[model samples]
Target: MQSYDVRRLSEIAYDADNGVTAELSVVVPLYNYADVVIEALNSVVEQDLTAVSAIVVDDASTDRGGEQAARFLAQHSERFATARVVRHHRNQGLSMARNSGIAWSSEPYLFMLDADNRLRSPALSRLLAALQCSGAAFGYSQLRWFGEEDGIGVADVWDPARLSTGNYIDAMALIRRDALLAAGGYATLADDHGWEDYDLWCRFAELGFDGVFLPELLCEYRVHGASMLRSRTNDHFDALMAEMRLRHPALLCSSVVGVNP
Candidate 1:
């Protein structure tokens, strides 16, 4: 993708030299969601948090999803301080693409958003405020399932035990990038893609950074046949669970996984 500087200094946070400085960085890992990626970008642009940057990592898509994303950002360049696209030389998986974006990010807080999903209005501000007030490692927003509209899916308080049995927390969360880096970023799982987010949460628990669940609806999860989570059946779930247990035996089996005190 081509590079361009077309943003005003007043719109973005900056230091003495007017270099790009932001409190949050929204990293979007794009695959082949050309149909809906713009809507996702729109959601990010409409966020209540003004001091934010966006990075789109296109994972060598067969379609022109990356180009479309670049075009959208170019048109709405002023919405964010910095908006750029990263094109992978080859087709890498979601985890690698996300890690690439993470490496490019310099903000203290980060939000990992898939191309298929989007944040609700005012989500970033609310999540950030709650994260600061609660002194938690990350802020998790309650999100509803799109396409299904099966009411709202609310997350409970920081429950590490529940993570062992199931991953109630979706990957759509605002987290301290430093803490995430300290615990290691999202794991690359070949057997089960669904376990990646769960494994990351377990790692956070292992590192003693508890997640704070915000019960308000802050995002919408799009459901479709091409979704990564929907593709995983019950066949590998058991194996994935066993793998998580083996990888983080101390984290899962210990009495301190969810215990805050």
Candidate 2:
């Protein structure tokens, strides 16, 4: 895939009045997760919010996931009002995939949902309400974990106050599109600390952008064998963290030490 400056793309594409006036733009990036792509797309479509638009970026999936996602969009195009599907010719990392989605979105607020995750009925609505009411640049709800078991377990609530102490916002959370662009999107991380969402949250905090956490469990984050967390590329994650600390000393503290309280 060709490399383009995400910031430049965002500046050129950030037009709030041109497209739908939806309260949220849900961007889902899919790779080879063909088995779950339809379900993920359906989850967003099923949301009760009428003004929401979803943009699914197919990151050059070698499998049928991209085709399946295109079919879903074709069948339920009206439900989302303005649903778009983008494809990359070659496989790019998650960071690039997400950046593409952001560039394609015109909504003021954005939600980053993984292809394996599904949102609860009112998840988008609740998160948007919190952002509106609190005037926070970003907002997220409690995430529930699901798998083979009917209900494996529920994740803990994300406390916005504790955000500075650690990474609280996951990629499945909601954020202001402009704020995300201002923070320079996701950074390329090393093996150990390459979790894209973690790096983004730290950057958000450093920029003085605030996020609100609704206590409601508004989304289900599925963890399967193919999940990125399970892959655990430690070297890449660590290298990313090291670079992040060097780039933003105030946000990450020192490369050797954990986030400062």
Candidate 3:
């Protein structure tokens, strides 16, 4: 998939020797979620790791969400090793928005946070530690669901064998930049209402990269009617699954379209 040019609004200098060593780039892709984009940015600013950098990609949001995010990040620029607000000239899909952020980041690791979600703890340090020690493609933790849904979203160890069934991990994870780029980043499927993360994980498994799971609730996911999962109808769901099967035939069997997968 092709990526487009983005306008850079705010940028903070990176000073590694002075304790501003940027290792992880928190990529927050914002669409029209103006109301909560700041919350997501705030979570990034609050990360305990001084090595944290941030890239907020505003995908041509009409709701002025991009401006809001730029303002917020500009206010807290000093808190990050490197902070940037990249705005897409037009509205690209979620995958491309993330790709834009990835293109702009200079860090070794990445963490994707939706605009409506927030980090519950100083989880980046722990996730970075796990990834460093395990040499995994990515590291994920349990998520706490809120808003329309309230509960703990559990995660499991990455198992390629289980991919044929369905995606068990969320997009909210700490990932290696090299592994992500090697996988060609997130797929921009025409039928993708969601499941981009699933496609990426399948590619990772195909590349012999595994994910490390940390059993801590480090992030909160807000579920609402406008959320991708809530908007996906049965037909939409089927079409996306069909696309997944076609793209990753080795990872997804016929069972992927069945009720079990």
Candidate 4:
């Protein structure tokens, strides 16, 4: 990572009127991951693409994550001239934090990033090209799960058509802001099955919003102890999948009440 001198918090907070239009808006909803938030922010900041805005929504983190992010913003004012930090008065779920970021962004394209994940420099350019050329509502690149490695080791590819049957695109995918808003954003359903991104993808299909998948790994998804999916037990995962199938009958080819081959 390139080192830059940190600026003052007040200086970073100053709002400037940049006449240039934003090509994309990156929204990261942060919880208590103070240790990793700066890395996530830097990934977006160092992107080669111009006219991109990074919006970090602090979901009322009780830990020092929020304070650390504010401090980083203070020193990196120029890097995030268009960037803004919004906070909730109380704790809201991840979906709510994402929705808040969407509401605040004015860019045409929106890229959702998990606070612990990092994106490669060309990832944004590649996804944007696919979205533009295919005329799809969104696009996703192959993901490389990161842990003890510095670069990509394995890749996950998805068929766009299969995604209609089951969610194949992760939350880090790039999506059109207008299409997302038209689908009514993320749904807050039963607490036991709060699969916000999956629900949103299903709605996108229903609304005839198209998407394409790029086969190259462009983002690094960190897997650690604090990972959300890791924290969920087997029963929790099963319950959530069951609820999802029940809620969206069209997505499942097999009987909702029975197991599939």
> Cα RMSD (Å) between model 4 and the true structure?
7.1
Q: What lDDT tens digits, residue by residue, belong to model 4 across residues 185-233?
A: 7766665233677777767777788878788878877877766444555
Model 2 stretches with alpha carbons more than 4 Å out: 1-20, 148-165, 190-194, 233-240, 254-261
Cα lDDT of model 3 by residue, 1-261, tens digit:
232233243232222222477888899988899998888888877878866788888787899887787777667777877777777777778888888788887789999999999986678999999999999889999888888888887567778888888787888999998888788888888775767888888899889998999888998888898876577678677778888889888778688743211
lDDT of every model, 2 decimals: 0.75, 0.70, 0.80, 0.70
TM-score of each: 0.87, 0.82, 0.91, 0.83
Candidate with best TM-score: 3
Q: Which stretches of candidate 1 lie over 4 Å from their true place?
A: 1-20, 253-261
Error of 3 at 56 (Å): 0.6
Model 3 root-mean-square deviation:
3.4
lDDT per residue, candidate 2, 137-198, as tens digits? 88877767777433323223444345435454567778887788788877666543326777
Better of 1 and 3 by lDDT: 3
Worst 10 residues of 1 by lDDT: 1-10
lDDT-sorted candidate list, best first = 3, 1, 4, 2
User: In candidate 3, how many clashes are counted?
Assistant: 1
Tell me how many clashing residue pairs each candidate has: 0, 15, 1, 2
